[model samples]
Structure formats: structure tokens, C-alpha cells
Target: MISVVIPVHNEEKNIEPLFREIVAALEPLGEPFEVLFVNDGSTDGTAEVLRRLKERDSRVRVLTMDRNRGEAAALTAGFFHARGEIVASMDGDGQNDPAYLPEMIRRLREGGYAVVSGWRMKRKEPLLTRRLPSWIANRIIGLVTGLRVHDNGCSLKVYRAEVVKRVQIPHGFHRFIPAIFGVKNHEVAEVRILDRPRRFGRTHYGLKRTFEVLRELLTIRFVLGNRVFYEKALLAGGLISGLLAVISLLSSHRPFWAPGAFLGGSFLFFFVWHNLRRFNQAQKEGVFHVRELEI
Candidate 1:
């Protein structure tokens, strides 16, 4: 069985169409499947539409949130309940095509990649509104996490059941799941998928959401900070160098001025000290413990 989980919010107009299209597309796969729709506190008629669909199709299940918890939270909830060996996720706003799911699954099964992400080759949304921010986000995240993906925000993503369960997701961290997998040494691949223009309600995301993405990118950097011992070493070295420079300048025995060589030597000593501290700490606490400290 393949579990397709979609997180929806206030997309009443597109729900019926997307559901019908998904049902049609998955029928030929010859395997039992389930479509899980997570209703994220939508105030519109989306909930009623999903309820009706669930009534019509026993394969369909609805997970309702008490309030709007964002896409990552909704997806996480759906993941826990998904019963399929292969789990897939896509947007519920009709922008992500269900027709490409077969190819995604094929690649995952054949290529041995743990996750297969969708690459929106040509987005049909407004250039200024969606495309521009997405491009900026992709590049910035690529630099930060070393995960060079074109459409990280594209919701048409597939993952192995175990891999999906292994990852930790926070609010708005859905877009960076690829980056998370990169650090964990998981094999990930992508395939091109069709991007449809919105047929009904306005976009759930906005400028504020983009800013939140930048903030999260910074957070991933901080979360992975201990992994880069050289950076912490440089910081510690710079601090000690600055302190030594100040001390040498004020000392009476010294040549009335701070010596550059002395400052450099001090910085080097502190830099080694910092690296040792980090290595010893990592040995004591373990790198996996990082997930426990929600920094």
C-alpha cells in the first residue's frame, strides 16, 4: 500500500478536483492505497468537502487539527498514522500533480534513494509572488545545508516509511527536509513534475512565510553548529586574540605596544583549546543528542 498524505488549509475549491484526479491517477498502480488529508484548521468549506470525500471513498481518511498548526506539523501528524510501506506527500491546493507519483515511486524503488523529491521544472504561478522567493530560498538553503535542490518547497515529495519517521520536523521546517537528510547522509534524488496554476482560493503562504524560511535556515545552521568544529575554533581564537591584544598594550613589561606575533600566538593557543573542548564534548554527549536540545 502507498499512503498519500496531503496537508490542506482553506482550499475548498480545489479539494474535489484534486481528490478526483488523485483517485484516477492511482487506480492503475494495482496496489491498495490510502489518501490521508490533514485539515489544518481551515475555516472555509474545505473541512466539509474532505468529509464528503471520506464518506465516498473508504481509502480516504481525514486528520483534523484543533487549530492551524502549519504544514510541517500537519504532515508530521499524517506520517505517524500512514500505514503504507511507501509514503508520499503533496500539496492539497491542486498545484502539485498526482500524475507524476508513479515515476517518483519507481525511482525510489529502483535507484535505492531513501527520498525522491519533486522538481517543478516550470512553475505556473506568478513570477513575482511565488517563483522569485522560491529561487532565492533554494540558493540560500543550498549554500547553508549543502543540499542543492531546485524545488525544496514543492510538496510533491516521496519518502521511505522509515526515513520519514526518522526525521524531526518543526513548524515551517518542511521546506528544509531535504537539507536535513543531506546532513544525515541519506541518499536523495529528484524528478521533474508538472506545476499547475491555482484554480481557486488564494495562496496560503505570503511574504511573512518567506522571512520565516530565512529564519529557519539560520536555525538549521545553528542546530548543526557543533558539527563544524573549525568555525567554533576560529571564533574562540578570535576572542582570545582580541583579549591578548588588549592585555599586551596595557602591560608595563611589554614594549609599550601590543606585539602582533604575541596576539597571533595567543589566538592559535586558544583556537586549539576550543577545538579540544568541542571534540571532548562531542565524545561525551554524542552528536545525536543535538536533536534533544531544541536550540
Candidate 2:
């Protein structure tokens, strides 16, 4: 069985049609499936529509929040509630194509990958706001993560139940799944999928959100980069050198020469100290955790 989890916010216009298309798209797989719709405080009669659809289809389930939470929370709730060997997720905005469901599952079952992400090879949205930003984001993410995924922001992806449970995503950090999963040695693959232009409401994202996403890109990079002890060493060396330099000046040693020597030597000492610290930490912990995982 496959569980499809979709997160929607103010998406009343496309909800019914998307539900129909998803049902038709999955029917060919010959596996029992369920669709879980997460309504993220939609004010546009979306909850009413979901309720009617839930009543009509026994295979459908609706999870509604009284207030709007971000997409990551909705996805986390869906993951915990899902009752399938594999879980699939797509956008509620109708931009993600349902047609790729079969192919994504096929790769997961046949190739034994923990996750399969959709790559928007050819987008159907407008050239400026939608397509261009997505293109630039994907390219920049590909370079930083070294995973070479074509679309980091595409909202179509499939994951094994275990993988979803293990991946820790903070709110607004869902787009960095590939980086997080890759660091943990989870097998991830990508395939080209179709993108559809919005037929209804305006895009939920804006310039502010785009900048926020860019900051997230940097966060992911720092999280995934190699941990070397040299960083800590450099810090220690700097402190020691500054102390020595001050002592030398107090003792009436050549002040100008002492400060320069202290600065150069401190930099070198700290570089080595930090690298050693990183090596030791890596040995102690199998994987890098920027913060305590329990939190």
C-alpha cells in the first residue's frame, strides 16, 4: 500500500480536480492506497470541500489544523499517520504532476533507494517569477550539496516510511531533505517530472520567502560540510597568541614586532587545533549532529 500525503492552504479551486486525478493516476499501480489531505487553516472553503470528499470516498482521510502551520509540520503529521510501506507527497497548488507517481514507485521498489525526488526538467509556469527562481535555486543547491538534483524546490517526492521517520526537518526546512538524507547515508535518486502552471490562486511564496529559502541553502551547506579539527585549533591559537602579545608589550619587549608575531603564530596554532578537534568528534559520533538530536 502507498500513502499519498498532500498539504493544502487556501487551495479550494484545485482540491477536487487534483483528488480525482491522483486517484486515476494511482489506480493503474494495482496496489491498495490511501490519500491523506492536510488542510493548513485554509479560509477559502477548502475545509468544506475536503469534508464532502472525505464523506464520499472511504479511502480518503482529512487532517485539518485550526491555525496555519508551515508545510514541514503538515508533512510530519502526515508521515506519522500514514499506513503504507511507501509514502508519497505532492504540492496542493496543482503544480506537481500526479502522472509521475507510478514511475517514482517503480524506482523505489526496483532500485532499492530510500527516497525518490522529482526533478522539474521542463516547467509549465510563467518564465519570470516561478520558473527562473526555481532554476537558480536548483542549480545553487546542486552545487552546494554535490547531489546534483535538478529541482530542490519541486514538491513531488517519495520516501520509505523508515526514511521519513529518520529525517529531521525543522519548519520551513523541507526543501533541504536531499542534503540531510544524503549525509546520513540514505540512498536518494531523482527523476524528471512534469510541472503544471497554477490554474487558481496566487503563489504562496514571495520575495521575502525567497530570501529566507536562500538563507536555508547556506544553513544546509554548513551542516553538510566536512568537519575538521583545524577550526577549533585556530581559535585556541588566536587566544594564546593574543595573550602572549599582550604580555610581551607589558614586559617592554619590541611592541610592534611582538604583536605581528603573535597574530601570525596564533592563526597557525588555531588552524591545527580545530582540525584535530573535528577529527576526534567525527570518531566519537558516527554522524555529525550540529545540535543534540534529542532536541
Task: Write down the TM-score for model 2.
Answer: 0.73
lDDT of 2 at 245: 73
Clash statistics: count for each candidate: 0, 13
lDDT of 2 at 121: 67
User: Against the true structure, whose lDDT is highest?
Assistant: 1
Residue-by-residue lDDT tens digits, candidate 1, 31-137: 99999888888899987888778778888888887778778778877877789999999988888999999989999999888889899977887788788999999
Write candidate 2's Cα lDDT for 208-269 as tens digits.
Answer: 66775666664454445443433444566679897987787677657578877986787655
Q: What TM-score would each prediction reach against the true structure?
A: 0.75, 0.73
Model 1: pairs clashing at backbone N, Cα or C within 3 Å? none
Task: Give me the candidate number with maximum TM-score.
Answer: 1
Overall lDDT per candidate, in order of appearance? 0.76, 0.73
